[model samples]
Target: MYKILKKQKWSDTIYSNWIEAPFVAKAAQPGQFIILITNQKGERIPLTIADSNAKEGWVQIVYQVVGASTLELSLMNEGDSLYAFVGPLGIPSEVENFGGKVLIIGGGIGIAPIHPIAKKLKELGNYVVSIIGARTKDLIIMEDKMREASNELHIATDDGTYGQKGFVTNIMDDILKKESEAIKDIWAIGPPIMMKMCTRVANEHNKQIWVSLNSIMVDGTGMCGACRVSVGGKTKFACVDGPEFRGNLVNFDEMMLRQKQYCDQEREALMLLEEKIRRQASNG
Candidate 1:
């Protein structure tokens, strides 16, 4: 059992947890993820390695309460334990000092994964520009952390309650229009629609873009084709092959459809969990 060393509620539906998983922590890299099961009967869920301390034997995972497993996981506290913790799986983000500036774009909870990648790029002596966005100011997280890793940090929100009154793509558009020639590469992690739109903008500017796909994954290995996605007209698995791929080559529409494949079941499961919680609260 991996102990939950610490927990912090980031927003109304999002939380961060530091888990004591020595082996996984030791092997973790910027873009890899872990498959966790709350209990023996729980469903497997994949969460990105937001941050890690190999020597300290812990990995920080930032997750939003979107499904049954995540809701149950969020109810867990610092002293709780997870039934199974398997990872540092998937390919690590390619870290290289690409001649000029690197733009890291993250939307909502996607900011977590970009944290480590931004840090790595900075270490490689690349000029990092991080753009993080959420629906509102209350949803923004890890501001100081991202600032420390990036040379410049920009923030955006759908409702102007925070940094800028727009999406991360809007900021990207502005940057591209001004400094397109100096941008070496762009890395983005977010909802499929957002990433797809970002890809369109980047492609228009002829920028190289990399995106991470958080598709529905079962097993964190290639054997489970649940996370298969089409890239450049070919099939690829997000678990083993990548959670990262060239954004311009990805078929975002198809990916978006696959993501909604179990929405009905997911909604039912979440409703059941919430009802159970309400009943338990009343009984207590």
Candidate 2:
């Protein structure tokens, strides 16, 4: 069992965790993920490797408590142990000196994974500009960390509660108008819809954009075939081939459809867990 070193609530539904995972921490790189199981009977879920400290023997993961497994995880605290932790999985982000400006776009909890990528790009001598957004102020996350990792940061919210009133796309459009030729590469990680929109914007400018797919993954290894995605007219498993791919070449509609495959079952499971929680509360 892997021990949880620390845990903190980042927002009403989001939580940050630090786990004592020496092996994974040592091998982890920006953009890779970990597959974790909460308990013996819990379903395996893949979480991005937000950050890691090899010497300290810890890896950071930030997730939204949206489902049964995550809700149960939210109730656990420091010193708690996890049933299984397997990772540093998937391919690492392709980091290199692009010799020009780099744009990193993140939406909602997606900001967590972008943090490490932005940090690494900056270290490789690229001028990193980060554009992040959420539905409102309450959901905007990882602002401080993104700021430290990037040379400049722009924020957007649908409600106008903070930063620009529109979406991150608005900011990206403005920047592209002035700096399109200067931008060497773009990396965006977010909800599927958000990534699709970002890909559209990049395509308009003829800019190459790399997107991380939140495809439904059953096994971290390639054997399951559950995380397959179509890119450039070929089937590629997000588990092995990528969670990241060239945005313009990916079929977002199909990927989005695949993501919703378990929604009904997920809702049922969540309802059952909620009822169980209520029963325990009443008994207590």
Candidate 3:
């Protein structure tokens, strides 16, 4: 059993948990992920390694309650334990200093996964510039953490409730132009659509870009074939080959379509879970 050492509620739908998994923590890197099961009958839940402490034997995972499985996991507290937590899966992002300057972009919960990457890049003596976005001010998270990790940090919001009042791409475009000569690599993590747009921006600037595909991963292994994505017109499994890949080569349209394959079922499961919870509350 992997015990939850700490729990934090970022928002109504988002959460952060620190789990005691010594082996996984020791092997964790900036871009790997873990698959957790709430119980014997629970579905596998794949989440990126947001942060880790090797000495403490704890891995921090940030997740959003999107369906029944996640909602069930969120109900767990600091003292709770997960039935199974298997990880540091997938390839770690290339950590070498590329010249000197690199750009990091994060959208919503994607910010969590990018935090460690930004910190690591900074430690390697690279100038890290990070752009983080959410729908509004209330939705923004980990501002202090990202700022500490980055040499410079920019924020964007869809509703103008904080930072720039536009899509992150707007800021990305301007920054890429400003840093064109110095910036050589970029890392973006978020929704498929967001990453697609970021990739487009990076390509226009002629910079190498990597994006995370953990959202499409299922079963946390190549056996499921569910994380298959087209990269450079070839199939690659996100879990085994990478949860991170060259954004310029990924077929974002197909990946986004695959992400919705089980939406209806996910919605139904959430609805049923809500009904059950309401009944339990009423009975209690």
Candidate 4:
């Protein structure tokens, strides 16, 4: 059983947990994820490792409480134990000194997965510029960490409650217009729609863009075809092939549709669970 050592609420729907998992922490790399099960009957969920410390035997995971499994996870507190926490799974981000400016764009919880990538890029002596966005200022997270990892940081909010009153793509466009020559590559992670727009902007400017795809994953071991995505007109499994791919070549429209395949059922489940919980509380 993995124990939760710390917990922090980043926003109304986002949370971070520091869990005791020495082996996973020691082996984890940027872009790798883990499969966690809350209880014996709980469904496995894959979560990116936001940060880790091998020596301390701890790994941090940032998650959004979107589905029933994640909602249950959000309810877990410090000292709570998990039934299963298996991995440093999937391939790590390819970090190298590309020897030019790198721009990292992350939206909402996507910023969590980008944290380690940004840190590694900085360590490789690359000048990193980070752009993070959320629906509003209150929903923005890890601003201080991103700032420290990046040579320059930009923030955007859909509601204009933060640094720039626009989407992260707007910031990307501004950077492309002003610092086109300095930019070598762009890494983006966020909602499919956001990543799609970023890729479109980058491609229009002839900029190299990489995106992390987070489709609905179950086994997370590549055994399940649930996380399969089309890239460059070919089929690729997100679990084994990549959670990251060339943004311009990915079929974002199809991916977005596949991601919501179970939304109706998921919503129904959540509603039932909430009702049951409320009724139980009243009965008690």
Give the Cα lDDT of each candidate.
0.94, 0.93, 0.91, 0.92
What stretches of model 1 exceed 4 Å from their correct place? none
Per-residue alpha-carbon lDDT of model 2 for 1-284, expressed as tens digits?
57999998988999999999999999999989999988898999899989999999999999999889899889888999999999998999998999989999999999999999999999999999999999999898889999999999999999999999998888998999999999999999999999999999999999999999878888879998999999999999998898789999999999999989999999999999999999999999
- Candidate 4 lDDT over 1-284, as tens digits, reads 59999999988899999999999999999988888999888888888888999999999999999988899899888999999998888889988998989999999999999999999999999999999999999889999999989999999999998899989999999999998989988899988899999999998899879899988888898898999899999999988888888998999999999999999999987898788889999999
> Where does candidate 1 clash, by residue pair?
none
Candidate that scores best on lDDT: 1
Q: How many clashing pairs does model 2 include?
A: 0
TM-score of 2: 0.99
Model 2 lDDT, full chain set: 0.93
Residues 1-284 of candidate 1 have per-residue lDDT tens digits of 59999999989998999999999999999999999999888998998899999999999999999888899999988999999999999999999998779999989999999899999999999999999999999899899999999999999999999999999999999999999999888999987888999999999899889999999999989987999999999999999989999999999999999999999999999999999999999999
The residue ranges of model 2 lying beyond 4 angstroms of the native Cα positions read none
TM-score computed on alpha carbons, candidate 4 = 0.98
For candidate 3, what is the lDDT?
0.91
lDDT of 3 by residue, 1-284 (tens): 59999999989899999999999999999999999999888988889899999999999999998899999999988888999999999899899877678899999999999999999999999999999999988778889999999999999999999999988889999998887888878899988889999999988988778999865666777888888999999999999988999999999999988889999999999999999999999999
Q: After superposition, how far is residue 58 of candidate 2 from its true place, in Å?
A: 0.7
- Model 2, residue 268: C-alpha shift (Å): 0.8
Q: What is residue 130's positional error in candidate 2, in angstroms?
A: 0.6
TM-score of each: 0.98, 0.99, 0.98, 0.98
Off by over 4 Å in 4: none
- Collision pairs in model 4: none
RMSD of every candidate to native, in Å, equals: 0.8, 0.8, 1.0, 1.0
